[model samples]
Target chain A: MCATCGCGDDAGTRVSDLDGTVHDILPAAAAPHEHPHPHPHEHPHDHGHPHDHEHDHGHPRPQSPGTADAGHSPAAEGRTLISLEENLLAKNDLLAARNRGWLEGRGIQAFNVMSSPGAGKTTLLVRTIRELAGELVIGVIEGDQETSLDADRIRSTGRPVIQINTGAGCHLDAGMLQRALGALDPVPGSTLFIENVGNLVCPALFDLGESARVVVISVTEGDDKPQKYPHMFLAADLVIINKADLLPYVEFDVERCVRQARLLNPGVDVLTLSATTGDGMDGWLEWIRKNPHPAAAAAGSAPRSGGLRV
Target chain B: MHELSITQSLVEAVLDRTGGRSVTGVNLRIGPLSGVLPDAMRFCFEVVSADTPLAGATLTIDESEGRARCRSCRDEFVLEDMFLLCPCGSADVEVVSGRELQVTSVEVA
Candidate 1:
């Protein structure tokens, strides 16, 4: 959805890096031309667990490739049946897994940082990038419903950053991030941080093809954020409790919030840090250094639980 | 909500799967934890699928309950929210089947 009404008016997603290189992923109105060859390929009955990625056409540019081949079958009177047991988000997820493999193969780690508005996501990113300074070549893809305000902040840090204006959209989908990755082509061995549009619900649903997903929450918000928006925490490998400096004045409970976050994701690493005072910054920096591909830390085996406080 | 974009992707998936056939309806199994609202999907599918192969397609939604298993006691139960506890009172539960958004089948004409 364009985050706008389907009025059939002018609509597009704009992606631009700091150097003013822009690319517009035009609306579906112009989508027909892109489907040059609709080769039919019947998908197997995978139902809900779609993990087959063997259909590699060696398609050069994968921001969002053309769609073709697939079908479904169902019981209906006076109607034919085409059985298709797959997830609607299968396309996006498949593209995301492809992007993940590309990044992992090159030893490049990407982080999808998400949170509600004013959670200090941008601020925390600025601090983290500066602290990592000479250590890591960081590239950022900032997403917002409208402005490039956060992109400006990241640019001020002198790191490579691209801004994706979703227009009416609520969160950044894999297609959006995949296109952004094309613009902000961080070199191999570099880390890319995709700062997703400020949202807890929708952002969690769309995997931005990141090596790890980080959900940032501030103490200014309610401590019950995890309980209210469990999916965000559940999908995240790291939960940064930002704005710790305000904890003395705010009624937010750190222990309670961490416990709640842990309940949702037993494997999640919680870091209570103040981006303002640089207190507890090392812990997060350490996490970035040690396990760039945090998903790798979780994906291979049964989930593990451990608490390492700094 | 991103339901609009989701609905768009969903329609494309259905149309692509149909392979140029005239589709009548779609059967979906959506979990409560899938983050998709059945009513919103039903409402948006009409608009997003307009002018596409899936136009006039009905989206039949089947909401499945969230199920989780406790690692401690190996007990399985229905999970409603994040604050789920096992019958044996263990909070360390691994969600086995809650977040699902799949197209079970499609009726073609």
Candidate 2:
């Protein structure tokens, strides 16, 4: 029988023999090019699970054109063709919404810090925390693929820090930050800084429910860094060009970097400073001071419980 | 590199939608511009689904064609590559396709 839409004479006779049910059916010419038929082949089953074993035995019959291949089924292919426009980042978006609500309720101003691997983000945080230790109570959540090294560094400065190891994940999504936030002791009048994993790509795509996003790029990494990673530049509310003290010794073009970054994000605040030497630390600290937690301040917030002073 | 994590999430999403029913297959419509690699997703699926209910579940990938529409000429055409332009030699175009990534459907038993 010709098997396009299952409307062939043979299909009709076969259906008539079974029952007098006339369901909507597609014609052979209208059928998609691919036929749905299960191909018998040996599939690997290395995991020792009973569920895996059962699935291995019963493979579903494939569907029509562009549907029945080795990987996907007919129903799935039809859904894909038909307008199943699901958001790719639905999970992240849901968590982000929840995180935003949680932060707003607490009246804490949270910001996500992003940078290249050696962009002096930790050093900047160390200096900022130390300088603002008396006025702004600060808490930090550090993200890394491996090692608690960054968290340990922040701990040495005697600040409240929580370390999240993403294992192989490239960025810190809102869900991961939510878990980390629970572990962190609440500081009523404090600013929360989430040090995202050292990646310029995926971190930009994720919203960690931060009030602002800061991107740190070192001058030594060259002026084209912003142009190369425009997504990160576009997403950042603040851009810090670190390692400014090394510009004299290294052949780095600061102007070009600033120009390109401005082209991508016209309103992005760019700050150049040397974290090691504290050359531009005051300007950085001033920016943080301007962002006051009005809701917490208005509530006559009490001092948080057991938070480290810088 | 992060494909394994994404695959694990994909498996969990399928299971969640199925309400604990056994999934026979999972279909994903990944656009060329989604920045996700099909081969990497396939490789990670096996490792991610190991010992889970979705283990051994087939993964089907569908590639979407890159298309754009010219704003100036009001002409629609397929983009030859990443350069968004109209077939009538107009660079003033807006991309309409080739940036989709979704868990289209799942076969549950």
Candidate 3:
């Protein structure tokens, strides 16, 4: 646990390029020897749901008299309501905006590819790299729980790749992507693919400031996945139904999936492809080509802030 | 769940603004579409706020309604869940409210 930042063992997360260069993602706030608390792990074994005791904080205080909720108000019991109005994801959003600024400055179209495990994200990426090898200068930031295997696969294709092993983390945040960018240093006018950790839920909540978000689902999974995990589908700018080769054997309903996705995001585009057999690959590639880097238009100008720097 | 990490961020944001003041209540605006469960956050808050300036701070979650505006008719309707279709038989809908995950205020001594 980091005493300075309150970040936990997950702070040990790092970015590794194909050249074996490794960079620790988190700030060196707390060293291992400085574990002052009894529990060294970030999540303690105590699963006591203190939700019932939320109001009973052992301090008795009356509510504010009025409904004016913006400023500080002295309550009847002498406590002050100091309005903060701060977004919970502000920190991540700031980092994501910085990442957007950097990516936009270089005319690099970065796509955040997210999906459940075994949904063939890496397979599709590998196939894309192979198919677009001559036309595109592609770079990848592969995120996994703790493995360089996917990065190795991307490296085998001869493109620059960086692996971010998120230790015990369910998803990749903007800070991790920023650190990976520093190591990868992808060239300008290239396509940067950020393969997020294989989790549909947590990754949707985080904004990595990518040009677009692509959620991949395989036919082996339930067709109702879009409805089951609406947040993931809602965040997706493009939904790719992968593993089309197994569509004949599986019970996945492509129409229902597309309908569910469209219900959440009417503007979302859906593509069905079998990465292994190269079926429906043209549409996928065309979509990538059509959706150019969002930041490319703002190139040569001052970095556009996401309302962070006024 | 991811609520733990979110709660940690909430604690940090609150403590950052408090300036060493002992916080008594932390008010938040959480919407259903925010992809955050208030119950899970409440449980995580108790765990993350331990030994900090926000220790024992009452987490008051204000759940916002999920509302959306139809692009065709401009009629604002209540969106209960992920089914984002508008009542005007149109699929194009713009999210007006909901999806709020903000730390509105803090009660301090």
Candidate number with greatest lDDT: 3
What TM-score between 0 and 1 does chain B of candidate 1 receive?
0.89
Local distance difference test, candidate 3: 0.77
Relative to the true structure, candidate 3 has a C-alpha RMSD (angstroms) of 7.9
Q: What is the lDDT of candidate 2?
A: 0.65
Q: Which stretches of candidate 2 lie over 4 Å from their true place?
A: A1-85, A291-310, B19-25, B31-35, B50-99, B107-109
Q: Of 1 and 2, which scores higher on TM-score?
A: 1
lDDT of 3 by residue, A148-255 (tens): 889989999999999988776788877778777877899999999999999989888877778888999999998999889988887888999999999989898899
Per-residue lDDT, model 2, residue A295, is: 66
Interface CA RMSD, all predictions: 6.9, 15.2, 7.6
On DockQ, the candidate that comes out on top is: 1
Query: Please, what is the whole-model Cα lDDT of each candidate in the order they appear?
Result: 0.72, 0.65, 0.77
Query: Tens digit of lDDT per residue, candidate 1, span A48-135?
Result: 6534334333322111212222323334454554456667676566656656766766667888899999999999999999999999
TM-score of each: 0.82, 0.66, 0.85
